[model samples]
Target: MCLGDISARSQDQMILNLQGCDIPIHESQDFKDFSEIGTGGYASVYTAHWKITKTKLAIKQFFESSTKEIKEIIINEIHLMEIMRKKVIFHPNIIKFYGITKLKDEINYAMILEYADGGTLGKYLRDNAESFKWENQLKFANDIASAILWLHDNDIIHRDLHPNNILIHQHSIKLADFGCNASSIQLEILKGTREMPVSATNRIFVNLYKECWEHEPEERPDIDQVILRLNSIPKSHFDSKENEESEIIDELDLSDCDVQLYY
Candidate 1:
């Protein structure tokens, strides 16, 4: 089947599962002070404070009385998050999934997730395009590649691998939004924004991007091969010094530095 058809099938299955399943929904009283931070076609994300844990979190709230397509998408996303949680494969480059919540009177469902202070990589690059260093860009690419490799290793394909789905947290890349089952080749070309300067990006990244968006799915390298290629790139100054204990300590101390990139 074509990518669009595959996605349609998946959505149909998800809708059926959602309608038939009796999934328990937790009370939304645990979260407070929800402030809208971001939004997508399916849901709106809010930064909320978890009353129980006293920690900040991102709550993705699905629209009330949404259409079947949007409901299917939300259910699929919840299903994917449940899988990740059950597997216990908590890779650093992947966003941390918490749990789901549903208010008693509201028709909308909410998903609790790790709050990414740095926001999406696409926004970060747009805001800091002029001053963002090449080395950091490479690091972000490596981190994203590693995350993708982990997902593939676990038999999950990130069919929607775009900059908006890639988040920045603690100055590191964390891949997000893996609910859709569309072909990667079909969606690869739609990964970045139009304003992004493709020519200005590192040559290695440019080549990798081209390879990823190839028309033939079989011709594209698997995630492991992609990781190998990213690893082969020359180490940055910080990476080179990581071998020294003192330098490692310094790096740990500087972990909170504001240089953040995504995707």
Candidate 2:
């Protein structure tokens, strides 16, 4: 077969795979007022107003001059988003993927996503460091865990999970930036060994964190189990703990942990 034939077959297979997925193909001209918001290693995101719906949306456009390897990564992420959409139509804590649009005079495609009004979690936390309370911290942790559970339930692993990747929509968390990474290493747990301040409820949380950081991947608790553990920590526990003098938050300080990331 000629190269043209192979390319045609590959396109056919992609269409077949996308059949019944119900994801829309949007036209680049349908959006206007594009303003760049964020940029990553592979793609740059823009805020655009959709002409059809008259709604503001985020347009994540992959770099146009990307190599074949980078293009493949972009395509893989599209497929991953499609798969997650197929499994769950809407997830409260996860970012919503609307459709795709090809930029004018460009071969690469851009993804239409819901706009997060409050920006990234990292920036939000930094801005509100002074007034951030225990209750707000609890809610953020729960929201993140809930989003991770949804991903795992749909057989998708969010390999790039961090505060900057997590966005704030209104006052809630929206998990984003799903990337490709399969290898894993153990993260050090700083519950028992560290001399950080801890309450009864916090001790339970620390134990759960330790379980999640188990050296053996199989021994680690899944996201679902992690959620259950979080829920099990009674509100009363936090109330009692907060009633006392507030030294610091109960979360494990990553700076104290010896976590080494490769690539």
**For candidate 1, lDDT tens digit of each residue in 13-97?**
3222233343444578877888887555556777889788789988777666456666666666767766776665578888877
Error of 1 at 149 (Å): 0.7
Which candidate has the top score in lDDT?
2
- Clash pairs, model 2 backbone: none
Clashes of each: 0, 0
Model 2 compared with the native: what TM-score? 0.75
Residue 226 lDDT in model 1? 86
How far in Å is the alpha carbon of 204 misplaced in model 2? 2.9
Q: Per-residue lDDT for 90 in model 2?
A: 65
- Which one is best on TM-score? 2
TM-score for each of the candidates: 0.73, 0.75
Off by over 4 Å in 1: 1-25, 181-197, 235-263
Q: Which stretches of candidate 2 lie over 4 Å from their true place?
A: 1-23, 182-201, 239-263
Per-residue C-alpha lDDT of model 2 across residues 1-263, encoded as one tens digit per residue: 01011123333122213444456778899999998876766678889998877899999887755555555666667767766665635688888788788878765567888889888776665556456665677788899999887777777888877666778898999987665642233232223242343544356767887677665679989887888888887766555444332334324243412221111
